[model samples]
Target chain A: MNFDNMRFSKEHEWVEFEKSSEVVTIGITDFAAGELGDIVFVELPEVGREVKNKEPVGAIEAVKTVADLFAPLSGVVKEVNTQLEDNPGLVNQSPYKEGWFLRLQMTDRSELDELMSHDDYSRITGTE
Target chain B: MSEPKKTPLYDVHQSLGGKMVEFAGFLMPVAYGSIIDEHNAVRERVGVFDVSHMGQFVVTGTDAREFVNRMITNDCSKLLPGNLQYTVMCREDGTVVDDLLVYVISEDRIILVVNAANIEKDYEHLTSRKRKNVEVSDVSEEYALVAVQGPRTREVIAACPFFGQVADRLQKLPYYNGITFYHRGAEVLVSRTGYTGELGFEVFVPAELAVALWDQIVVAGEDCGLAVIGLGARDTLRFEAAYCLYGHELDDHTSPLEAGLSWVVKLKKPSFCGAEALRKEKAKGSKRVLIGLAVSGRNIARQGYTVLRDGREVGRVTSGAFAPTLHKSLCMALVDRACSAGDGQFAVWVRDKEVPAKPTSLPFYKSRAK
Candidate 1:
């Protein structure tokens, strides 16, 4: 399920921006996290790292395989989810909340206009 | 979603929240919930897996017995019609093509189940060497493979509606044996074989009835505490069983003798593929031996991580993981013949750190092997 506050990307990542601040949070959608299965390690980008839109910024390692997390918007990393170093499953446990991968200071707000809304994400997923 | 390809229990897996992944061009469940949870589920209780991606082949004709005996490492001549054997398809240098389960269905017919990734390679390899009358045909896409495994798995099979009579007959079935049976209005072919160390059954049925049959078994075994397992659990369980995972443990470049599978080579089984190479290797002794590693701490040594002796690379970890049963790190690797037994453990160059590890006996995790 997608939310109005959450923007979806074709690569299955989601971004949520606070209404008043330019700071935005990113995480994989529940669908992507579920598909990855039992993340054993989470490699987070360092704070102040510049990330390009749709480019790999970090990685998630599952028991069976490994997947890199992509930045949905061009931004400077403001904060990294440090709790993930020991407990990577937080991404699978609450992907939209505490499971957030990074907080970024958005450099391009215009990128949000190109993202898919809840309905488009639902269609892309082909299910609720 | 547009009918790309469906495993026998694809629908069932979806309904149960299986997270599907693209594997070898087939849509298969990587896990249902948490891989660790699913992994533990199969180790502790009865679990079902949709292994329908495995390729099955049919070989039949007048020279079937002789052809199969000369093709694989196992002694096919001694295999009763209904019996099965775990064997390997090898190369000229004693390298294993694939480890497979071969079953003699009748005097003139036999079946070989192979890895999905090696279907074409195995088919082409087998066909290149023609026998007098034995015709080899690929029947992989036509059959659905389902595995029900764990300690309590026997109870589930015993209670399934159509398999009761056959289950009775199967009760006496020893390891590496198989039989064709009727189950739930379907022609069910079952083998007493499994990758997991737990007692289990692998069934092959027509693709058309795969989903329904899987559902019937699940619905029937509900009272027996059966959980629909996934590939995640299937892998972890097998890894814990110390089973040699293809691609990781054995490959075209690695020989059976080096992979610690010399026992299955049936070196005495006259004139099979790579028999000469294997005999030669046996005489010379192996230069590298595949061994098990145990990490004393919680840190895991993953594949591609280099094994170290005094900070120098000695070998590389081929496969490593947190074994659910052992609750510790277990790994398999090919190490140099000169390396002495690790004094209980050693170090692995994992990422930027030298992870502490120990050399454990074969099969880092042990279950019902006997």
Candidate 2:
């Protein structure tokens, strides 16, 4: 996955869109993963479930604390990452690739413009 | 509104990039890097912890022993010099005041180490009960404690220049015993006791010399893979070992019997604070008891979460975490005595769902001799 092409949410989630499909992949940013420490469990929204932007869809449990995983954009859940059931540490190891949370069938593709670009996200995370 | 207090090793923790957090009104390191790495380091090798945030009090006088015996639940009359005993202080109603370690320096002198958050309250309690011939003083500010624990602890201590001569003594020091030795014209008290279920030692030194002592031990244990641990791993380690933390497993409203600390309470003692209440509770049996719960899933159960049996709330989790050593999600909870009986199953409310769980024994982990 090209993180450069990803759009970011203020809640630290990122969405990547395909050129020929309305389906987009979502995951937490590397900075968010690092801050949360070791990831032990990831609760993903079920496929076919519709979610609204900024809504609480699932949860992530770390060794220290638990946090809510928010929906980055309104859409229908296409596919949930079943691999995370046995290997939640994948989020810590590869947040953008194998650790991608779920695929969403976009309701409105124009919402991508409201999300921050990679550079803007980096600036907000103080990584730039 | 006031700045949090700092330990003597504050600068050292910052230099090592420790993640600092406020605990018990003191700024302490939660972890230097990965808490799991630090936890594993202690299980496999040796690790040092700067636990200077814990409080200490010195009791000395002709009536020291007699006075102390009246304040705690443990039978300290059998405690000889150069020995340590784990005990709990209680209020008149038999609820816990604080759990502490009593180091018998001599017949007339003893040192009590208590939780940092309970320092002032414990001091006040001790002073208020002062008798004609006894003197109780809060010496917490004058001391710093460092714990070196794991299988390789003895080798690491022997490798140090200051402790080499006493290596054999340290190796021979039985568990729950201590000795005083001179280090650079200062008296350092070393004890064979630790919270982790490992062969370990705790050293008490003058606060001013804490930095030097920490640095030397770090260098000596470098070859043994001794990592500096923090409070994050400390809680996990102790929880796995089934050690009761003051605020979590114990509180003013919790009794020692309910906390599974009956071994430390002595009913045969002639007279002690809360003796009558504890005796009555012992005869009547406690209404609630502490029990271990092992969750069946990866979702961890945290403190304050409710435990249920047949869809009814039975208890609340006091301490819970993913056990790094056991590779299981476990917790200690205080529940209705009836729910903890027989072969009943439990479920812990994690987030919006109730995850299945079952009662288990205390101490999810134990160290195997090498």
Each prediction's RMSD to truth: 4.6, 1.7
Error of 1 at A63 (Å): 1.3
Q: Write the per-residue lDDT of candidate 1 for residues B274-366, one digit (tens) a residue.
A: 999889888988877887888655456778788876666678888888776776778888877667345434678765568877777887666
Clashes of 2: 0
- Top DockQ prediction, candidate number: 2
Question: Where is model 1 chain B poorest over a 10-residue stretch in terms of lDDT?
Answer: B337-346
Candidate 1 Cα deviation (angstroms), residue A79: 12
Model 2 agreement with the true structure over A3-122: per-residue lDDT tens digits: 666899999999998778999999998999988887888989999999999999999988889899999999999999999998888998999999989999999999899999988999
Which residue pairs in candidate 1 have backbone atoms (N, alpha carbon, C) closer than 3 angstroms, thus clashing? B345-B358, B346-B357
Shift in Å, residue A70, candidate 1: 10
Q: What is the TM-score of each predicted model, taking all chains together?
A: 0.81, 0.96
- Candidate 2 differs from the real structure by a C-alpha RMSD in angstroms, to one decimal, of 1.7
